[model samples]
Target chain A: MKRRTVGRSDGRKVIVAAVLVSLLSFGPTVRRSDGQDTSAIDRGVRIGIIYRPGVRPGLVMLPRTGQGLDSVRVIVARDLDYGDRFEVITLPGGDSIRLASTTGPRRSSAGGSTATKGATAGALNYPLYQALGADFALDITAAGDTTVATLHDIAAASVRRSVRVQLPRSSDPDFRQAVHRLADQALQAAIGTPGIAATRILFVKDGKVYRIDQDGADQKLVSSTDRQAMSPAWGADGRRFAYMEFQAGKGWLYLQEMGSGKRTAVATTGSALDFTPAFSPDGQTMAFSRATEEGTDLYTINIKNNCCLRRLTVGRFSDNLSPTFSPDGQRIAFVSTRPGLPQIYVMAADGTDQQLFAPFDYGVTGASNAPEWSPDGQSVAFHRDVAGTLQVFVLDVRTRTVRQLTSVGRNEDPTWAPDSRHLAFVSDRSGYRQLWIIDLDTGRIRPLLQQSGARLPAWSPRLSEATSSTP
Target chain B: MKSVSLLLALGLGAAVFAAASCGGNPAPQNTTPAVDTAAENQRVRDSIAAAEAERARQAQAEAERIAAQRRADSLAALARAGEEVRSTLAAMIHFDLDKSNIRPEDAATLDQKVAILQANPELRIRIGGHCDERGSDEYNLALGNRRAQSGKQYLVSHGIDASRIETQSWGEEKPLVDGHDESAWSQNRRDEFEIISGGDNIRRP
Candidate 1:
């Protein structure tokens, strides 16, 4: 039985294993091609720790040479670090390079050679950084409202990729965003997957909806102050999102377009309460919960035409809410109280084959709710009221096995990133309510936002590629 | 001049007669009646002055009585409002673990809310649903909705107009208690009635 299980698990991770195998070979081949250190394999292992459980790509950021782009360099470094797919390394006082004065007095070329004078502080010391053991080193140069990023494979001793991005000098936000895009492109060249550093997380803080950058910068209020907003769900188009707002003691589902900042409330019949709106992957349909005098149940609305309203669940007196759709838009997992307690349930997009999903005893594992289907559709993450407190748990859809992800404080409202490798949830483990992210591969958990009182985080799809402003 | 002298002589004869009478001690019987009449007039004037003072005092007491009655009516109105709030508070219905059905023990409370609504015809209330902080936020919201709907249904069954009652689910956001135990959970999972309109119409019996 153990052998069979091992084989099945290995088979599921064939793609990840293949990538690791190729990376391991690439390092040695690059060394051989350079003829610099044939016996340096052992040194490579000693200098830099590599091959983690799931290998996070290693990157080193070199000192930047620019005029008035010190802030841009910091933005790029921070973006790459927050990507979570890379192991970013910075030299001692290396981060201060971005904070240093870009307009200081120049060195006197009369005292020495011009080349020596120009190489005073911000020159690339390749050998020293190469020994520091990074797979790739990134060099950024800013000149006249444009920045160029060059990724050099350290072992191969060759330039892997170079990308030049033009930024608007009038706006600091646009310039920083351009730098983020540059860093993402460099990471994509090193690894096959692009970074989500340019994306935004929409959440509710202090009863108002807000949007913040992935690195917790530039926090902006997105919803109206007249009402309390909750459960923000980003649309696939990256420009639109839907949230639940309470006005005049009634809940209304409103869709907000970020470009125009125009909010339109969904038109539904009756005075029934509507909330927890989730947009389909294609942004055409929205699945939400409606509580009427009859009961609370899951329903989907055709958001484009504002017409086809279809009820998904038939809970006479029970409640079915918090619907999350699969990446393929074919299945939806939601919380249902039909069996007397809230439990995760999965059904087809058309509301067929509805059945209990998680394997739990009545009072043993507690009740489960807030089901979020991962972008990869392999697992469903939800919080269970277990052992006297709520904890986050991920249930493998194929194996029907559940694993607890959080052990500290009460963790709830787990939402996935675009890569499906990380999740942002709410935890009071730090003695206050705050947003936290847990990397599944590395088993590393960190606070996402420095400002507290954040909840119900919904990550937007790769906004760098989808947003018009990003180049 | 002769007519005038004749008239003056008659006046002088009357005056001499009056002066002779007033001066003579033997005329005491005639002067005694005049003295009695003067005393009678002074006594009548004193009686009129006392009657006027009594009328003024009566008017002042009547004004004070009216002002006191007005203050008492205002206090009674305030007490009526307080009683309305107390009745609605007493009508708070709590739920078991995850169940939304109205409990039998809470039926009397719901009945009280229904009575309050029935008494004040224009009064409208919002049934706010709540939950213990032990579940997902979105799920708790749905559970709260069910709990509130259950409370509203009970009120409707007890002859309250459905239009007069609205429902809101706070989920676990607004908690009556904050402790992480059954005691707090029990109090937290309750439906509270908030008077949204027509509060002024709540009158005391």
Candidate 2:
């Protein structure tokens, strides 16, 4: 009779947790965000990083222990929230909930929260937390030059996973990025996909190229304020970038290193008006648009040796500009004006097999431009004019089926994050041009930058080179 | 009327001198006091006529000086020949949406430039194409290039040396007007000319 009563109470606890989660969650709402209706990519997305409706997992950060570890706790919590896979509970100050502190040596298995009782909520009063709607909690203990993070499942009342991440002293230059990488790994451990916290987005603000982290911190200007700079892009390694700068009545492309600030102007063509630089996946070649009296055409040069400048298109009198290379480096997608209005067209990297990539009616659609191939090679994101306003659109590479992703405001320049599930674009939704990020699966929209006058968002590739190894 | 009066006064003085001459030179017959008095009166009338003619001549000179000053003032309001030629060269030629071909009206504008270039062989100029903010940055760059190149082609075809003209495209980066509607856009989609060298004294077209 006693065993039956215990079982009944356990079932009631699970039911109460589910009900509370539903009441507090903000589900996916409607947004053109700008794309077309009736897309297969939105329906039967087998491999999409989709989130279940009305079923958000609750996450909490166990109050940090040890000095100089506050940033680790705060950043990880913000990152996981931005990841859009959790309901990140913000605990009030001064120990609103019971948290066990660990000042001693790190535990061999999982620290604190003994879980010796097996199959309960937390080590102390976890059943109470479960009743309060927490699904998981992260306990972080700072050790010498390393931080130990223990993941605890509240309802199961057991340890889930533990990871020891390297975090140099706060004075270290890369200390913040190291913390960002740790958050990415935590999301990878909590969910199946890694977070984009470690990635940096390059954008144009007040005619200068600026770089910002995913959490909206450390906004640094990468280009000179006096010089005219636009269309900044990076290769897969994220070590260097290519952008267009004006000099002596012509636009010149420059390759700049992120580490030592070394810059060199491209040597392919010195006479024509050149702009819109894109790097190949291997970082060996750069494809750009050059214009002359004959016409505007696509051109590629071997940046590794800075020789072998090759022409990609020859539509004389018709403009062919804005080249975006495919993830495999075999093909490039660009904007061409051959069919009345500008349209997106794809061609082989060797300037062969050129064809229209994005489909639109002759007189129906306005214009399609700024096509960017995703890092995963599954889709190409660009903006198209719908009626009179420009909206963001995505094309599935395999099916060639296009879907509109935004319609709320004038959204343009859809650049994909390294994770491929989020896009950083410029939108005037708040009455001014600003950078906003959208997660494809969760349908969550958040402003990436606070200031207006920001455009040409270029997301960096995954920044885990120096801090690799997933949790 | 004033000229008629001066002519009448001269005529009267001439008659008086003739009477004096006739009376004095034709006869040593009469040495009458009344005849001498008449000669004195004639001399006095001649002197008055001379002073009046001098005043009239001075008035005419003052009128001419005022007219010349007015003409000079009007000329100052007009730009110098070199400045006018520069304005015609600097006159921006506009293009249709996504088009670079020279229109008939814009061709007329270019013809003015060609004439200026031909008139001043030592002159060299650069044409910069621009676009509205409707298209993407990359697309606008190409469109701007085409507009500028087409203008250069027009000048070359009109017998202006290609070497004397340089072309560049500012794309939509630089705008003559800061607006978003058609008024701003129409003004933005244009080609501007700047003197590169040897424009110290441009000959008017």
Best by TM-score: 1
Q: Which candidate has the top score in DockQ?
A: 2
Where does the lowest 10-residue lDDT sum fall in candidate 1 chain A? A37-46
TM-score of chain A of 1: 0.82
Off by over 4 Å in 1: A1-54, A94-128, A465-471, B1-54, B57-64, B67-71, B74-90, B118-124, B161-164, B176-185, B196-200, B203-205
lDDT of 2 by residue, A1-471 (tens): 000011222444356444433433323223231212211122110101112324456677765444578777877777777776666654432132233443324332221233223222235346644654567777766557678777787877887777897886666667667778888777777766777888888888767888888878778888953788889998779888888887788788999887666789898655777889999999899999998877788999999999999999998857899999999999999998889888999989999998988888889987899999998999999999887778899999888889988878788999998778889888888788888888886566778867978999899988875522211
lDDT of 2 by residue, B90-190 (tens): 99898887677888888788889889999889999999999998777667888888888889999999999999988898888899999989999889999
Worst 10 residues of 2 chain A by lDDT: A40-49
Model 1 docking tier (incorrect/acceptable/medium/high):
medium
* Per-residue lDDT over A357-414 for candidate 1, one digit per residue giving the tens place of the 0 to 100 score: 8888875668888888888889999998867678889999999899988877788889
List each candidate's DockQ score.
0.52, 0.53
Give me the displacement of residue B172 in model 2, in angstroms. 1.5
